[model samples]
Every structure is written in structure tokens, then in C-alpha cells.
Target: MLTPRARPARAAGGAPRGPPPAAAALAPQPAGADSPAAAADGSPARADSPATAADGSTLVRTGAGWIRGESTEEGRQFLGIPYARQPVGDLRWKEPRPPKPWDGVRQAGAFGNRCVQSASWDPGYEKPSHTEDCLSLNVYVPDGHTAQRPVMVWLHGGGLTAGAGEDIVPDTFARRTGTVVVTVNYRLGAMGFLATKGADGLDGEASDGVSGNYGLLDQQAALRWVRANIGRFGGDADRVTIAGESAGGRSVCTLIASPTARGLYRAGIVESGAYGDCAGRERERATGDGAAFVKKAGCPDPRTALACLRAKPAKDILAAQAGFDWGPVVGGAFLPVQPKEAYENAGAARVPVLNGANSDEGSLFAFSRYDGQGKPLTAGQYPQALTDAYGPELGGRVLTAYPLTEHASPTHAYGATVGDRSFACPALRLNTALADRGPVYAYEFADRTSPPFASLRELDTDFDFGATHVNEVQYLFKHFGLATPLNAEQRALSRQMLQYWGSFIRDGVPRADGGPTAPDQRTRPGQVLSLRTASAGGTAISTTVGDEHRCDLWDAVPAG
Candidate 1:
């Protein structure tokens, strides 16, 4: 069962802060009507005529109250609705509570504050924008439409630490595909993952005298909110498809196996994430480590832990946060068992699944370059490292599959092999497993050799990061407005990709209209579509690139 609260922040002892300046300024504006005479004059007429609503204004009814959103050209309706009550003060480390109903139309044009996070990787990270009382969601829908449309809920990825729903621009998908898109913000870091011993001494349960896995609970609250209120936005809540990449993909996998999330979404797309058995119930006993760390901080007991944490400044929390490898815990009422166990026992929702991975996932996490102290490992070092990590025999097999000699440098080889095993290979494993339960579509993005980012230009490497992680996003969203225009062939392929994705959301299958048919047409083993640049101009497709690339080899490879 799940518990909901309104304003857990107040219970924690701290008062909620007023809406930030950004949020306060989202009041709706009126649009202006243009006159034929004025248009003939060609003089820039008054921009805000009587016809338009002033900037940043919209209204939508929600489960809790009437929410007003800011307007943008991307869509007709947008609501920055608060799905769960603020988690401030006393509510600091507890599970999410339901948001209290407001008496009147609540202004929701501005984005809510993001959860407290470090400014290490993200330049937009600001202090005022980070807080404990951040449990809001943003909704985008077609303008003036009352009919139900397919809904796509997006989860952002920042390694479960940084990134906001506001960062993603839904204009392309909303305008091009005509789907209602919802992006959400959830708790992160210690605030979300910390597990305390319950009264019953169980992990992630109330018995530990504390709530745990608050982040996961926060997502559930968002989904519940969508189910209860999406209809108001002309969205068919029952047809909702949850999609995400990276850590968001990990969360999708978790939700796939989470009993609480069973009926929340009908289909799921996990890009670059895998369903695997990592740490499980028995492994969570060490969550008491938080208690020990608190004790080391000179706190008396668990009761004082929340207060002590709150009283400590944000910087202190960040500084002390080092050395803690926090993530979702199993054995909780929410999870019940490990994800792998749930998947194997057929405990997961029986829904169509689309799972795939980029060719080079580890390049994004090139820690050696970031640390600056260690030299990039050489090709000779990879085999030993693999052997050390996975044993000599297994390491030999891994080396044979990912032969470092095939690459120009050791770093390139290591990154490719690790990325394949850690992300790509496991994705294949997941698809294989899900295929037995329901219709499954699997893919591998292999676009290689794109223009290098300014940061990587100095590397002077010829290594084929082959479709490095996130490279597919450009084609998927078309947000950047690339300088080099895609030729006719490329445009055709782009349309096909978009149509496939859009159709998949509309129905359960991702099929294109009027195309060459093959044995693996749509549903067959080794059925994969390869999108590549053709010699003539735009792009070409090979029904199955695996025959040439030996993609089936991926199925036998063990996950790192």
C-alpha cells in the first residue's frame, strides 16, 4: 500500500518558501489582434493585440485544483502542476505526501525549484533553484483541443543526481507528433535514497521508524497524479507510455518491476538501460551505514538524524555526502524484491517493450579525463583490468569478444567494451527476456563519426565512438537545428523514425506505412532496422544490420 501526505516539509519543521521569482512571473498575458490596414503599412503593429493571452498564462483543471500555466509556441497548454506536497522541514526524509488542495486557481506558469543538487557538472545549477520542497511536474498539450490524445511521460537522467524536467523541450514531439508530454522532477541523492532501520527493522518500510526510497515514491506520486488528471488535458491516460534514457531508463526498468507501478503505464521504452540483478534485499542490511555516519557526526540516535541533517548547511551535507554510494534499496514495501527476481518470476507488467542501447555508452563517463591525475589506460591494461574485475577465464572471453587490438588506442577499446557490456549488451538481454512475456522490439544505434564537441576536439583520436551515447537524441528530437541540412534521403529516414515512434505510442507496434517487406518484416528474431547515411545523399536502411555486424553476438555476451 502507498501513503500520501500534504506538505511533509511543514512536518519536518521548516516553513515553505514563497514561489521563486521565475515562477512568480509566469502570469498569463493577452494576445493582440492585427488589422489589415496596419498589416498593409508593414510597420510592426502592437505585438500584444486583444486576440492573444498575455505571455505565460493558461488554465487547466487538475485532481487537486485548477492550475494555470505559462504559454509557449511549442504547445497551446502547459501546466507546472505540483503533484505532491512540498518536502521541507520535518518532512525532509519521509515518503512523498499528497499535495493539499488549493481553494482557487493556483498559478503554475513557472517551473518549481529543482531538488537540492551540486553545481559540479551543470552550469545552470543555482542555489535558489535547488531546495528540498521540489516535487512539481510540467504538462504540455496541443492548444484548444478537447479530444483525448496519447500521453508520453518523460523522466530525465543525470545519474540520479542532476537534471530537471524543464531542461527538456517538448515542442518538437508535441507539435510534430500531437502527443501530450509530461516531464517530472523527483527527489535525488541522499534525500531520496537514504534508508533507515524501521521499527520492525526492515529496509524501505515504516518499521525502520523512517521512510526510505522516497525518490521512487515521488515518481509513483507523479504517475498517480497523471492518472487522475491527464484527461483534463485531452490526454488518454490509459494509453500512457513512459519513456526515458540513462538513469531515467534505469528508473523505467525499476518501475517495470515495481508492483506499485503495475497499472500506471501500459507500455515502456527504456533506452540505454537494462534490467539486471544488481544489489538485492540481503545486500541492503548495510543501510545502517547511514546511522553509523550520523553517529560519527556526533548525533545521538536516528530520531535526531533528520533534524541534524536539516540543521546542517547544504554545503556541509554535500561535503559529508562523499563516500556514500546511495541508490534504490530492495526489500521495501514498494519494491518487495530485486528487479531481476521480479522480472524472472513474471511479476512485471505484461506490456509491449522497446529497449535499445547506444554503441558507446562509457565514453560519456570518461572518468580518467575528468580526474586529470591518471593517464588514459593503454590497450595492455584492459585485459588485466577485465580479468581482475571478472576473473581470468571470463576476462579472456570478454577480451575475445571486444578485442582491444581492433581499436587504435587502449582507452577507445576499454570504453567500447565496457559500454557494450555495461549498457548495450544488457539491453539486449532485457529484450530477450521480455520477448517471452510480450511483444518486444530491440535496436542498437551504431551511427559513428560525427563532428566532435569542442571539449573532445583536443583528443586527436580516430577511435570510432560509434554512435556515442546520446547521439541518437538529435535525430530523435531535432532540437539543435543542425547547420548542415539533412538531404532528402536523410529527411525520409528521419520521418520514418519519427513515425515509427509516434505510431508506437498511438498503438503498441512501431510500423511504417508502405515499405519494402522482409522476412523479419516487423516481428521476427534478429529483426533490427539500421539507419545509416547512404553514399548518394540522405540515408538508407538495412532491415537487419546484425547479419553483417554480427549483432547476435551481443546476446551471448555477459553484462559487465
Candidate 2:
């Protein structure tokens, strides 16, 4: 029942232009050969280059070539390593291919260019990017690691249009969790998700003239890369976990339903990402969107649309897709059915899932629509706001259930309604759907006092963000390439969260030594873990999540 609409670019960065220079052709080495002679086989060792430099930089050899990364007190970080060939020119909308082997050592000290996107609040990515050589991933390996550790592959969330792997530096998290972390960058916007039906020219990427979902395919290719090469970095490829926030979180669920993604990951962690009832766009809708996009991009003829669109500049495609929604397309081999159907029918990957949302999941969205635009909602406008968001009939019932008298302001009431209907209820429903198929753990981040990311702080609005969307990301990792320093109490909560997530990634189950026991949804039914600071009663088990979030009322509301 999820409908596609123009997705907002909520994150930031500058737009970079042009394609990356082709890699110098080099003979491929045997995969996973780590001998000293192998290092000598590629390029002569630099007089100043040492395995461990005084600046803590180190050189690590991957299957394709040799690369150097920097070291920190916590771990060694390899940034901007290409996972796939640049999706440019003839391969614009095609499926990702294995990266071409490169000669000599590829300096991985800096992150590669982010996928072309318009700017927003994301710190390092505030400028728009025009580069297509963005299919890269960053690796974080804890220092002095002896054995193969569990691996966590992170996907950044920007409504599938913005953000990159550099959004969060996970060296500290990798060290604390004792796991290998890999953050990835995939195609975004029109270059990533444009699908046109009857476009035979695009059939090379998929069967039956299918198109779109290139971004999702890029992610799969990254996972394949991890499976093939993670062992060389001291990671257990078989124990990989896929986790993300918002759009990335939705991708986690979609991948669970993808037949092609089976065995790529052992488990998934969803953070405030169960929007649209955890469903994918239908094929007809996706094709309609794509066809419209094709016409707008000056490629109206389906017979020649693929070639025309691919010939257009990447910037032109980005401009033409300004007001379109981009996401996975159902009815293809990549995604045969809606994710909701997959979970209900037990067709999804049978793996453990840890899913949850924040306490005020809708506050940020409401603020953006109201106060963030300098037009705070008034008491008189509350009814109309609900009617606009939901239909008049459903809005009336929602208004009656959440009156202004019960909230601090009109925005608060609207936020509560949006949060329950969009995030909280959907997550609860997904937990129940997956519980019967496999172990399921649920949680609600209740630390309302959590600090906003640097971008939000710069917004300089009086809107109380509470534990809104993307707020919990800071407790687990550095957000938007900047660290949100935590207070003593918040630090404790961060440690506890790391414990829960680390345990889930390392083992199939989520376990924390002294924290509250996270009960499986199958056994606990309506119960969930409430993540908070010690002064706020600390992290503990809660049996009132459904009632508090008003899932009972939302369950009966119309999905569309």
C-alpha cells in the first residue's frame, strides 16, 4: 500500500563534477595473497612509506591491489575503496560490475566523491556532487585484531537521494564493539532508480525490459565484495550484519525480501526506518514514474529512451528528477514482491532482526514542515493539518484521539500522530510479522534529551527535536562526519547501545551484560526495550510500547 512520492533531500554536501580517471591496467593478483613478496610484486616500497608510520598510517593489500589507509588509536581505516566499476556512460543505469584491477598502490587516505546529489544539512556533503565514480566502501578494523571478527556493513540514509559512507566514522565503534565495520556508497537519485517499461535498450541490466533499482543492486554488489574479500581484513564474511537508518533501514528490510541477497548477510538492524508499512513500490507505479522521468529528460520514446537518457549529462538527469520518488521496484527478479508480503508469507530471509523507532520519531518531520519553515502551527490550524496529512475521515478520528489539550502545542500533537502512523506502528507490525519466522527484538529509543547533529544545531530553531528521526544514529556512531560529544549519562546510554548492537552483530541474539534483558518479540508480544540514560531509569524492558505509541488505533487506519 505504500505510494511513491517526491522524496525530500534531508542530508547535505557540495556537488562535484566529472567522471573519475580510468584505473591503470594491472595484472590481477591471486585473491587474498598476503605475502611480503606480494607487496613487492606491485610497486617498490617508498623510502618514507612503512607498514606502520609515525602518523599511524598503514598499508593493507586487498585482492585487486595494494592500498594504504590511516590508523587511529582505536583502529585502522581504509577509506574510499572502490567496490564496483564506475556506473557511467553506457553503464549509467546498468547493474554494477566488479571494479577493474588497478596498478601500484591506491591511496585510500581520503573518501571518494559522494554520489551526485543536491546539498542539505549533512556536514561534509553540504555541496552537490556530480561524480558517478561513487560506488565505494570504507573499512574499519580494530587494532591488534587476532581472529576473524564479526562484520557490520552500514548503509547511509538520505531518503535514498543523499548521504555517503563518510557520514559516520566508525573507528571508535569498531574498536568498542570488537567488530569490523564497512560503510558503503551506492547510486542515488535518478541515476540510481530510474525505471522505464518496454525500454528494451535497458534490458541488459535486468530481464524482461525491467529497469531501476540500480542503487539496490549496487548495495548487493558491495555485499558480494565483502563476502569475497572481508576474510583478508580479518572479518568473518559469513557473520556479516546489514544495518542502516531511515532510507538505509528500509533497504535492510528490502534486502531481507530479495532472493538475490540471501546468504549475503546473517542479520539486520532497522533504526526508525519502517515507513510506508515496510512495502516496496509496485511495478506499474515504478514504470509510470520512470516513463514520466524519461519524458522530462527529453527521452520520451521508449525504444530510444535508454540511450538518450544515458547520453544526457548526469546533472541534467538530476534536474529532471527533482520532484520524483526513487526506491526499489517490485515485480522483478531483484524484488519479486512487496516487502510486507514477503515477511507475512515467510518468503523473506530467515535471519534474526532487531527493529525499532524513536519515542518522538515524527517531531523532526513536523518541525521541518511547520516551525523549520518559520510557520509554526497554531491551535486553530491543527485540524486542517491533520486533514491534509491524513484524509478528512481518518483525520477526524486522529484529531479526536490526540486533542491539542493533551499536547504542548499543535505541532506536538501532529508529530505524535505522524510518528505513530508512519514509524512506530509500522515497526511494531514488522516485528510481529518477522517474529513467527525468526527471532525478533524490538526497542524504542526514549532518550528525548538526545543532542541534535551539527546540521540540526545549525538550523537554530526553537523546535524541540526530542528523540526524533536520525537522532539515535549519534548514540551508535559519529553522525554526518562530525562527532556529537555526549554527557556522562548520554555516554552511558551510548555504551549500552553499542553493547546491544555489537552483541546482535556478533551473535544472532542481542545481549548486554548488565543492561535490561532484550526479550524476543515472539515471546514478549507487545513488549520492547526502552533505551534511556541511568537518570531516566536507564535502559529497561517495557510492556507499554504499543499502547504508548497508539498502535492499536493506527492498526485500523487505512494504509494509503
Candidate 3:
């Protein structure tokens, strides 16, 4: 249910990519509701409506070329702009290449197709239809943002199997925070993560060439594109921050560890997808899956495997890609080691980190037959689930620490137990590692009564959603309309959260004007922000989240 983040005691940029550039500026607007853009072809959009007019198309120039954008109330939005070459034909399974320079202005009024993946979260956010050629990004520069405003790059989450950049509208963040935002859609599922030996003119024994982690590389390409051209859109290239949740969060973690991602951004925010120690086996297993897929696609021969796989229907290849482990693989050139190892060795990009998880993270995986109204499951149910998940020894310890009577139901008890050991504590563990290395800030979003995105409510069953895995997102951004409308107190919390994040992007530290100060682990060990609502009493500055989550117990449980 929960994603993850890295942490360290309170404290505080990496390599520069591409060639150097000249200074840039924003042309002042006429200072009115209705105004004209300064430059028609290559000038920055009017701070009010720089490139676009009321109810008309806006245009902005990227490093590659000029593109027209769609207009919104807060600012002009450039949607479905390709950052890299379409990953189709021979490009499939290969590292992303730069978009072939365009001859003329491209129309970016609508979103490109979403990368091929499984079904999206029905009713949560409207994702585009699936296609193999779906490597695009969207940019939203708020009306009043200056040339020096912080740029927030967003990656959507669906456990690396689904989601697209268009899923979340950038209007809320741009309007609320006055920040330039870019959301990207990378390759997903088998199309993105499949690994194979002797594909792409390389072999298992060959030295580092292209990685199987193409999704990660696609994200890198987006960042690089931003580095080279975001200034044209009024973004400060030096002040970029990468942010995401769930599988998107996992992307953030891997990016921090990726050598290619060095100097790409100044900060990172991982909501819940940053747990679990890395293993060297993901590459091998994914490689095996690729081999199986090639055979199943009628391309067992190494010579034509890639070609045949590329020629197959997207759905057919994805059907073959489903059964394997589809996340990032360690022991590849991009990783060289596990993400945890990279962070601990100070091998990651040493940017200021803001990482945390929700209070009730694991309930989403609730057994369908069982309801989750916080009801206690049968005594035997919780224990057996534990024993089945972990052998009897660890299972008994889990049961003793969390007996059925302590919860509303056996389902809830089991969920709570798995949540603590699996999501919450592991995240805290990551924060501890981060704190040891640099300035880190941690938080626990505990506003349980808040409504999820309208689409997420489609998932409601007999069980209560609580402040589960994705609930915190509503307090931060619209999350592509995945969140419900906020009440007054929840609205205040949302404002506070935005202020904190804005401050972090602007100043690399999460602090509020009159609110609680989130502390660094070195100066204030074990302190984390309790992002609750005034309705839930009041937001906390120093919540004992580690203690409540029973991190000590999880620390003792052996790693699988």
C-alpha cells in the first residue's frame, strides 16, 4: 500500500550534461488578464500567457524545435511533446535516442498514447490508450513564474506496469506552488523492462552496452532534455527536482543510483516506492523472461529474436512480458550494484532528499474475499497468512507482536502487520541510511479520513481505505484527478504541504512559515513530520513514527 523514501539527519547537485548555454530572460507581460506573448516563434510565453492566448494555442521552443501548446486558465500547457525518438521499429528494446529534429512546429495539443502496459486504475485518472511509441512528456509553466523558478519533473506510478504523465494534470502544482512542472511517460511493463542476452547486438557476456532497464533510461532522457531546453520554458535548469510516488518513487530511487542520472537534478522526493534492499538477480530473471518471450513469440533463434518481438502486436508482447519480475535490475551497467548499496556507499547523487510513507500502507493488497473495515480477522487467519508469507518462525513472532484482538479484524491485523514490516519500517530504514549520508527530511502522512482520487474510490470494497498507501497524494497535488475534493481542514493541510514542498524545491529544505519545522536526523534523530489535518487534531512536527511502526521489531527480522 505504501511507497518509500530515503532519510538522513537534517543537512542539504551533481554533474552537468550537454553543452554550456548563454543566459536567458523572460519578456515582461502587459500586466493584465488578457495579454500578448513577447515572441511569436522562440520567445518565452507571456508570464501571463506568454505563448498562448485566451482559449487558443500557445507555442514554446524546446532545444529540438518549436511546438504549439494547449491553453488552460493557470498557464499554457504543451502536451504529448516527444522528448526522445519513438521507441518503435528498430528502436524497440534499445536505449532511447534523441527525437529526430523536427522540420517545423509540432502540434502538442493532446497527450500521446500511454506506453503499453496493463489496464490503468479505472476511474482514477484518464490515461491515454496504449502504444509502443509512447515516449513523450508534458510541460506546464504557470502564468506568473519567472525564469528562475524551480522545475519539478514528475513520473507517474503503477508499480512499473501502468500509468502515464498525462494521468495527473499539472495545473494544481503550477498554480499552487508557482513552479514549472514537467510530467513524462516512459516505456512500461515488458516493453520497458525486458532484459535479454544477445539482443540489440549485445550479449550477456558483453560489457555494458544498452541496459535492460530502458524505462529508467527513458526517464534519464527526459531529464537530459529538460537540462538542455527547459530554460526556454522559463525553468531554471540548475534547480530541477525529480519527484514521484509508488513505482514512480522506485524510478526516483534508481535515478539517484544511476551514473547517467548524475547532475540531472538538485533534489529527490520519494513518497512510498523506495523500500527493499536490492539484489543482483533482477537482471537474470528478467533476461530469462525475455528469452521465454522470444521463444513464445516464435523467435527462439537469437539472430531474429529482437526483430520478431518488435513485429509482434504490443498486446501480444506484453502478454508474454507479464509473468516476470518487471522492476529495475541490479548488476547491470546502469546500476552496477543494488540501489541501497549505491546510497550507502555515497555513490548516489547527493541531493537533498525528502522521503516518507503513509501510516496504513499494506491494506491495498487485502484479500478480495475479506473486508477491510479495520475488523479483526479470525485469530487463525492472521497467523496463517503470516506463516504462509514467512515461515512459521517469523510468522509466530509477527502474530505475537500483533495479536488479532488488537485490531478490528483478522484482515486488518494481517494487513497492519505486513504493512509495518514490509512498507513502513523498510522506508524508515532507507531514511536512516540517507540521514547517515546527508541532510534528510522524513514525514508520515496520517490523514486517514481523507478521500482518495475519485477514480481510486472505484476500489472501495467492504474494507476501509484509511490513510493507506496513496492517500497522501491528495494532500499534495490533484494527482491527475485521482483524489477527491478536500474539506476545509484538509485544504489547509494541502496548503501547508505545498508550502513545504515549494520551500524544498526553492531552498532544498522542507519548512513552513509558522508551522512545525521538519528536522534533520543528525541534529534531531528519529523526528519526522506527522502530516495530519487540524480535523485530526493538528499536524505534528515531531511524531514518533519509528516507534509506532515497530521499526525495532522489523529491524530484527531477517532479510529475505
Candidate 4:
């Protein structure tokens, strides 16, 4: 594999410092909420099963309180449930705390407020009711579930700066495959990743107090909540599996390697995201941005930075961090070391990993340079873009491998090269790293006609995204209302994928009943399960990744 990046920073004591930041311990729901008077508002629930409480809604008695949900034929959805206390005011930038108790039955009918994200260049950065009190999560339990089913908690992806979990609920994913689904919201941008004790003088310490990665810490708190509360929702907390796409996928990969997340999950699924390749050490980025925020907030004094920064309006703070890539950073007690090294040694989490990338994962990324009218790059522009992206030598090799004659245009070839280098190869590297430890099942999602999700510039730009990033997500869950539906063939592929995923979550193996007969090639070469179409050799499982995607030469490319 490509020599791993600079080793990540680690601390001797792995736990958070400064007296655990006040647990804000959540209280159980009041007994009065279950009174007959409250039950009269809605039809009283007949105690047929344990998933629902009185009032006929799919109610769950969580540690914080009783959450009343909207029950439908498809599933019982409890939305906008606060997994942690609101991270506003003094709680801002501190580790997530358990939500405080609520009064009467809390109505979980709609999605919670999305975490604040700065103005972005991608269409996925669409508008939402932005707020700092966005530590809520949603849970959907499928119908006819009497036992503890495997849970799949989803984390949405937007480069760690934007996007919300409500975009794709468990409407179809739950009903079809008998699994509980949970979607979560975490802090983003400056609110999420301000990694320094210098300014806040809180999580940051003179010694090992550099407290950044609050977003990731939020994910951990959410998972811990699931571990404690999902059982009341007919979910097996012990059988929980964490899944995410893109930045969310990176979160899953991070959790796999994080000492903080050990034993919280049984299996992990990463789609279109890997570790170390995307976000990096937060020391420099966070320090630079924190300094800028201090200046912008008019809080130059490090001693008074917290008070002054909080005094500033939310819009000004967001504007200050608009262009910065503020996401998870290495160091701190959260992600202490480089994820690759953490998972590389014998002691890393030995759970099963079902990870893969789409066939054209990088097509939509070319939108920044592609000209109008949906054509490829110009003859001169193609070489310039490649050279600028990969210096000279590697860029030339990438261009030669994907010539204009092979693809529709120069842009198409360039997109392929980007996909191979950024996503596909790194995924292969992860598979290699984890195979020796346990059962490592990798795949290639090659359904070119798959429907797309998220309101993005590429969708409206007349560009053929061609099974690009986030395309596979539509099949796993119903896309947003405005997005199109899947075709017949795509539906079949979705069923196949669901079966594989469900089996893996339930049994820690991708196949329905088998223990994954794929050879253990970590010390040598390995094969991957390719999810191609019926016509393209019918979803063959083999070690042909080198020839199929030209991974051999791409692996040798510098810094690929």
C-alpha cells in the first residue's frame, strides 16, 4: 500500500481531561406522561408488543424521557429525539453531554435542526434550519419486530462541513430488510472542529488539552446512547453496525480505528469514504482558523476568547470559516493516531468491515472544471488540469491510461483517474490492511444507471454523473422527494445489496449463511466481490481489480 501518512499524535492517557465536562445526566420519562389522561389525546395503545407505549404512537422509553413517535404501516419512526444536551452557550465545543429530562411526552414527529455549516461550493450544502443545538438523532423500527434486530446507524456525509441526516430516512431500508435504522446530526465547521486550548481555554490544556473533533465525539455520544436505549426500540444494541458515506464513511473508518469507539459496534460499513486520505491533523488548520475567528469575533485576548466568540453573532462566525475544510483532525483523546496505523496492528478492532466504492466515484467531482453543455475538457485544458492536480509524471501516466479514445471525452478519463486514485485505491488499501485481522469483504458498485440523491449542481448541470459518489445511497434508502426513483434492474441490485448488508450486520458476514470463503490474501494478493450488472459477468467475485480498474499502476502513483 501507499506508505501511510505521517504517524498520528497520541496521548498517554486516552480519556478526556478536566473532570469529564459534567455528564448532564438524562432522566427517565415522567410517569404522568403514561397517565390515562394523556393516553386519551390519542387512542390508547393495546399492549400487544414492547416496541410501543400508550397513546397508540410507537413510543420508546429512553433514558432521557418518553419519546412519542409516528407509527405507520411501514415502520415506527421516532424523529428529532435528543441524544445529548444542546451544545449551545457554555456547552459549545465541549464534549457532548446526555440530554436533560423532558416534561410531558416528547413528540418526535419531525427532524431536528441541522448542525450549522458554513457557506459551501457544493449543492449538498443546501439550506436548513441551522442551529447549534443540533445533537439530536432519529430512530426507525420496522413493523412486525418482536425480538432484538440488528441496528444500522447512518451518518450523512458532506465533507464534514455540510449535510444533514434527514435527507434519506429509513422509509424503505427498514420495511424491506428487518433492521432498526438511526440517523444522527453532529456539529460541523467551526462549531464542530475548533481544536485548541489557546482560545477556548477549555478542552485545550497547557499539557494534553488540545480539544478538537467535537463532531466525532458527538458521534461517540450518540452511539453510546444507542447502546443504552436501542433495546427499548426492538433493536439489539450489541448487534449494532455503524455505516456512513463519504465523510460519514470516513467517520465509520475512524471509529473502527479509534480507541474511544472500541466495543461500541459489531460490524462497520464504509461507502465512498476512507481515513487519513480526506481529513488530516487539525493542529494547523484549527489553529489558523481559531486565530482568524478570534480576530473576526473581536476577541483577540486568549483569556477572553470564549466570552467574546460566544458574544458574536452566529452568521459572523460561519462567515469566518466559510472556505476552510473544517472536519475531523488527528490528535486529542478522540482520534489519537493515524487511522491506518491504529487498524494495522494486531490489537485494532477485529470486527468485520464491508467497505467499497462506486464505479465512477469521482465523476461529479469534475464539475469544478468541466465546461458548459456537458462535454469533456478541452484538449489544452485536460493536460493543464491533470498537471495541476498531480504534478507532471503521475498526471501524464493517468492521462495515458485513460485516453480520450477509451472514454467519452478527456473529462471522463480524468474523472476515472480521480476515482481510481482517491476512492477505489484507498479502499483497496483498507481491505488489505484489515484482511489479516478478520473477515474483510470489499466490493465495487458498478450499477451505472443508479438514481442519484441530494440537490446538487451536477444533477442540474446536464452532466451524466454515471454512478458517481452517493449514487449507491439512493438504493439503500429512499431518495428525497424531489429525486427520481430507481429503475427495475437497479431495484434488483438494491435487494441483493440489502441481503448482503443485512446478513453482515446480523451475523458479521456478507453472505446469507456462509462465513465468507474468500481467501485470506493480506500477506499476498486479495480478491474483491464486484457488484456489477448481470450482463457484465453477473456480479462476479474475484481478484481482477488490478485489470478492471488499473489499480496496479494507480497504486504506484505518488501520493495517490
lDDT of each: 0.60, 0.79, 0.70, 0.68
Off by over 4 Å in 1: 1-57, 77-79, 126-130, 144-146, 201-208, 275-289, 292-300, 366-374, 380-393, 450-464, 478-493, 513-523, 535-558
Across 510-543, the per-residue lDDT of candidate 2 in tens digits comes to 8786787678988888789999988889889998
Candidate 4: where are CA atoms >4 Å away? 1-57, 118-129, 198-210, 275-279, 282-285, 296-298, 372-376, 454-462, 481-483, 512-525, 557-560
Q: Write down the TM-score for model 2.
A: 0.90
Candidate 1 is scored at a TM of: 0.79
Per-model TM-score on C-alpha atoms:
0.79, 0.90, 0.86, 0.86
lDDT of 2: 0.79
Q: Which consecutive 10 residues in model 4 have the weakest lDDT in total?
A: 3-12
Residue 6 Cα positional deviation in candidate 2, in Å, after optimal superposition: 18
Residues 1-560 of candidate 1 have per-residue lDDT tens digits of 00000010110001122434433232222221122112112343242331221122254546565555555555654545788988776677777888876644466655677776666422234232346667888777756544578888888766666656654556566666778788888987667766666665444334234545677788888999889878767788799998877667778878888898888999887777672423232434536656655565555566766567767664555555546655567775677777777777897778877777665666654433321235676666778876875688877876776776676566666665556556765765576666656777766655554433222333445444556665555555522222224556555655656666677788877665533221122256555544444433323234444433334554454444
Q: How much RMSD separates candidate 2 from the native structure? A: 5.0
Give the local distance difference test score of model 4.
0.68
Question: Which regions in candidate 2 have their CA more than 4 angstroms from the true location?
Answer: 1-57, 199-210
Highest TM-score scorer: 2
Native-referenced Cα lDDT, model 1? 0.60
Q: Over all chains combined, what TM-score does candidate 3 have?
A: 0.86
lDDT of 1 at 95: 70
Tell me how far the alpha carbon of residue 185 in candidate 1 is from the true structure, in angstroms, after superposition. 0.4
lDDT-based ranking = 2, 3, 4, 1
Query: Residue 406 in model 2: shift from native, Å?
Result: 1.7
- By TM-score, the better pick of 2 and 3 is 2
